[model samples]
Target: MRPRLLLVTDLGYPAAGRTYRDEDIDLAARLRADFAVAMCHPLDAAPLMAGFDLVLVRNSGPVLHYAEQYAEFRRVALESGTRVFSQLSGRADMAGKQYLLDLTAAGYPVIPTVDRVEDVGSLPDVPEYVVKPKLGADSVGLRFVPRAELGAVTGQLIQPRVPFRYEVSFYFVDHTFQYALHAPDPGRRWDLVPYEPTAADLAFAQRFVDWNTVDHGIQRVDACRTEDGDLLLVELEDLNPFLSLDRVPPGTRDAFVAALTAALLRMLA
Candidate 1:
């Protein structure tokens, strides 16, 4: 019998610059050849996942829309040993944005982050700073403020707004780099094109994959190139990262599918 996979997603989710359903649709179709794949909305995942051999979440939209349901799904999956792609535990975006502040404190080359409003001084004295909630995703609830006004909010992070030239993302499967895509126009976040990553670029992205500790799952390390020609971490997305398969070449897309298929099989093994 084929492995029964429950693919969690929100078919009707309205993403800002991309189609959430289209990507998940392609992924579900690709995965169907290897497993008995069925797609469902994220809110129904907790109750429906019991019948599947594995639960693969892709483009499920932000958990902020259904935080309680997402919590319960995580709880049941962890307690029952229900295999979840990207796993139920990840230290990066999966566990809120706290890693940003932690990594900053550890002196990792990341956008300087401080959770407490008073600690805004630790960031560079830039004209503007970014303020966002720890649990925010998809730039939701994010605002730009002057450094002096950072203390107006509590329990949020402050970082100097970098004037990035372009943004690049490194995609990986099971710690192996798959392919990369970048936003050529800095203002257009999702207008992606295939990127050829240098060895040094791969090394920068690989560090976060090593830190995540999820042995078998997809991850995307997002970084931005500063005006000084340096790259700093933007986000490490370990949970249901939207792979821009449509942007990559057909061969690269096929490779990604093959890599993901093997990872899923290994996960169930």
Candidate 2:
């Protein structure tokens, strides 16, 4: 018999720049081929997760929206030995934005970031800086401020808003890259197109996927190409990253679904 999988998601939740419901619907349909799949909201996961052999969290949106419930789900899942995709073991988004600060400190090719007001000067001098909540996602509470206004926003850690040439994202399933996508227009982030990644680009994204150390799950390494032709890490999304399935070629999308299906099988095994 196929293993029962609890697919956790918020299908009705409206997200900016993308549709969360459509992704989950398509993914669930594909996953049902190999498992007895059931879908539920993020808030209901903690209570429902125990019934399934593995729980798959997909497109649930930022956990910050339901922090307490998410914490409860994590606590119960770990204690109960319930397998969760993008495993609770994730140290990136699962742990919050602190990883960005950690990467910055370690000189990773990331957007230089600081979390404390006093360290604002450590960032490169630029006309403007971007600031947002450490636990925020989907650009929630994100703001850009001018150099002169820096002092007023001193309490917030800042990063020089680099004028990146383009944004590219690397999608991986259990450390193996599936495909890539990019937004040619910086202002139109969700207007994605299939991206052909070079070996070097794969290596750059793989570094974080290796560091994340999840033995099973899906991850997206988001980065931007600097004006001088260098890629810097923007965010490592190990949580429910919205796969731009709508943007990729049909063959690429099919390959991704196959990868995800295999990963889930490994997790259950």
C-alpha local distance difference test of each model: 0.90, 0.89
Question: Candidate 2 overall Cα lDDT vs. reference?
Answer: 0.89
Residue range with the least summed lDDT across 10 consecutive positions in model 2: 149-158
lDDT of 2 by residue, 1-269 (tens): 88999888898888878998998898889888999999998999998888899999999988889999888998998899999998888889877888899899998999999977678778888988999888888888889988787777644457889999999999999999999999999999999999999999999999999999687988999999999999999999998999989898888889999998998888877
TM-score of each: 0.98, 0.97
Q: How much is the lDDT of residue 186 in candidate 1?
A: 96
Question: Evaluated with lDDT, which candidate comes out highest?
Answer: 1
Pairs of residues at least 3 apart in sequence or in different chains that clash in candidate 2? none
lDDT of 1 by residue, 71-190 (tens): 899999999999999876788888899899889988888999988876776778889998888998999899999876766878887889999899999999989999999999999999
RMSD of 1: 0.8
Per candidate, the number of residue pairs that clash is 0, 0
